[model samples]
Target: MASRRIPKAAGCSPIRAVLAGPAENVITEKLILKPAPETKTEVVQKNTSVHNDNWFELMAINHLSEKLQAATGVKSMKSGYESLVEATAMVSKIYNPKRQQELVIQCLDSAIPKIILNMIKTLLPQTQFTREYFAAFTTVFFTWLIGPSEVRESEFNGRREKNVVHVKKCRFLEQSNCVGMCINLCKMPSQAFIKDTLGMPVNMVPNFEDMSCEMIFGQEPPASNDDPALKQPCYKSCRAIQKHTAKCSS
Candidate 1:
């Protein structure tokens, strides 16, 4: 018998396929806006790009700054972090290498506390719907929830970290027919608006009509069709027939 060739085992985690397509191609509850596969979403909508870029820059600075902070704890003199060599050399005070390593290790281990991570995950649900706005939201939500972290404030006392980066409105150019965009945005399910924008017969959805608001959710509907706001065009359409009219009235 011929010898059989054995195939190599795959890595434990499967790699995701890269998306390669135009920027306009997006799938959302709203319209399908396409986006280029390779482009970061930050680039597609340039107005939103500025705020998003700050996040990426901040994350990058974090890597470099970690060494600077850790270096302070290092009682010893050397650094093996090659990527940071230039940045480190600028402010690195020579210390005993062994003591520094111990401090660095201890500082790293205790850097991210569990309480903050739990708070972050709780407030920021990792979902497609809110991903675009999550980082900015995380900043806003944290300040609202627990106020500032004592350590961060105490360390950088005078200089304030600006969490609220200004995000500008995307006023797309007049080049394309924005009619489609306008109509789509005006549709219901904005998630922000609780009441139906359509004012569609609530009955359109299954069983929504059969049960009155009061019956279903223990909340009363408008008392009378005469109420100006609740009075819909449907009332006028059927108003020809009086509810109290006799059959002989015909």
Candidate 2:
């Protein structure tokens, strides 16, 4: 009787056949891999919320907070927006209105090195480009204090330009909830800071009704007496008003 011949698979090796043993046995002895158990560390990471969106945002907040504390000589127990508000309130208490504005400009001066300021002033010409550049820069670098913002078109020197930063809702104003704080601690100081340190003038017009603010770059800020923001009344819910002993010059 002729011996029956066994056919090899298209790419099967004799070694594989030896390792797998008989085809029937190989089919029955299937190997299943169970995923490794999740570690406690992985579980914790999965449940954790990401507080800082990016490294730049976190660094900016920390540096500004440190500068604010240094300017006011008051350490904040909290961080970020709360810390800024605490330092601002302390600054208001520590200095006169004029001095409060001065300290904030000084804080910004220290926060940004004079050399960097010089470079910005010397390199960026005072033109529409510079205004638009700083407007875009503000939206990117100052989102922590101002919240989400966008650059919009506005008339600068009778020409339409995209040099306005419309802050949807100012975090500083909303959190402080004080018109005086908004003007002394933020609007005036910020305009001065930008003008002196960045060599670009800006006018921050805040709408007390909705807490929104529009920063018009290249426009000089109006005088305190002429400013509508200064004339606005303090909120009844203001923390300063809540203190009863404190008077808010909103």
Candidate 3:
């Protein structure tokens, strides 16, 4: 004899889904409010045996609602199975060991497709700041990192604009697309840092001859600025790099 079922009205939580994340989602937490070394009541000396263990601080970044945070950087896909075809094609191009090796030495703008790099940024922040075996997680986590502006705008056929949903949590102004805008530019840890450490252990790195693809997401029309002189240069850079970097998707 078994019970029928649990009612939908009682207790159900999305926490597990949020925490047991996927390639497309990243979970971040706030840490700005913590006391600095001077303000703290406890002091642990680096080489002293008498120092106390530090407490684990597991704070959470407020979850960006999926719609509010769908990826803005990927190109719109063709209908039906072609979307799968297009995506698979992109993966085949990117996953080459050659590209990965090139990526180790190259900037996000010069090495990889902007969408691929952007998707990586979207998921890793939620990876709990743990270890550096990120390429393993990139396959699964990259897809779940959603962007709100992306989804709403998707419905409008490039005509309908969605009102922003603004929520402030920690230092992240949660609703602004600016967060996504800054994803690669702001969140990137330099390849130099990565290579320096990885070289100590796994020293082998690959080489890419010539890998070129336009960035579909970040490449947009140059944003208008007040100073005419400054405006022209920015417009030129944005336009010139259209051969590779996505102009606008963040």
Candidate 4:
């Protein structure tokens, strides 16, 4: 009881004690506790980096679409699908499949640059011409130019290869609905582009049943006589087949 008088309330609050200390130290401590401005900046930069190519992608698509239109003689972009098929049929009527392939190659050759070819050449050795590299390139480049496709990797011939690009529903095929057009226009030219131009062998297999197709990269194509793609019958929905009332053969 003698000292029962409670110790006077702490002479100063803890905050006051801190405030009473060196102003510079207090300011430094506050700054240390506060979040850095760069933290917010870094988050913004990361998001922007991922989305940096909007204009570039748009430009690329526009350029490719224009080239396709020019090559196919399709004046209107609105009717690109129909025009592409019509143009293919016209070409098929005028030229043999082999010649059609050469024309398509010439068109593509002009559009894609020597620099890109050189880059591919440089990277091909580094990548060992693996299926994954080619598949990735196809997805990023070809799909953007054409339509959607999926890359499926599997073991073949005693090696793992991401060699297949599965087009679940091809825009060209759906619009054309003709087996001959698929072979002459898309399949043959694509094979030639990949194999002869890009130096990667590929065989394009079109399945008309579901309007799906598989582009098998890194594989040699069979002879036309032995190829099932050559043997495919015209789709029931083919306009030519319907109009002519005739079956299509290789």
- Model 2 TM-score, all chains together: 0.75
lDDT of 2 by residue, 136-185 (tens): 99898778768889999998678899999998777777767677888888
lDDT of 1 by residue, 169-214 (tens): 2211111112121111211111111122111111101111111011
Off by over 4 Å in 2: 1-55, 243-245
- For each candidate in turn, the TM-score is 0.18, 0.75, 0.16, 0.64
| Candidate order by decreasing TM-score | 2, 4, 1, 3
Off by over 4 Å in 3: 1-106, 109-150, 154-221, 224-250
Question: Among all windows of ten consecutive residues in candidate 1, which has the lowest summed lDDT?
Answer: 203-212
Candidates' lDDT values, in order? 0.27, 0.78, 0.25, 0.63
Which candidate ranks first by lDDT, i.e. highest? 2
Give the lowest summed-lDDT range of ten residues in model 2. Answer: 41-50
Please give, for residues 52-95, the per-residue lDDT of candidate 3 as tens digits: 21222111111111111122122324432223223322322333
lDDT of 4 by residue, 95-137 (tens): 6667667777777777789799767756675233466777767
Model 4's alpha-carbon lDDT is 0.63
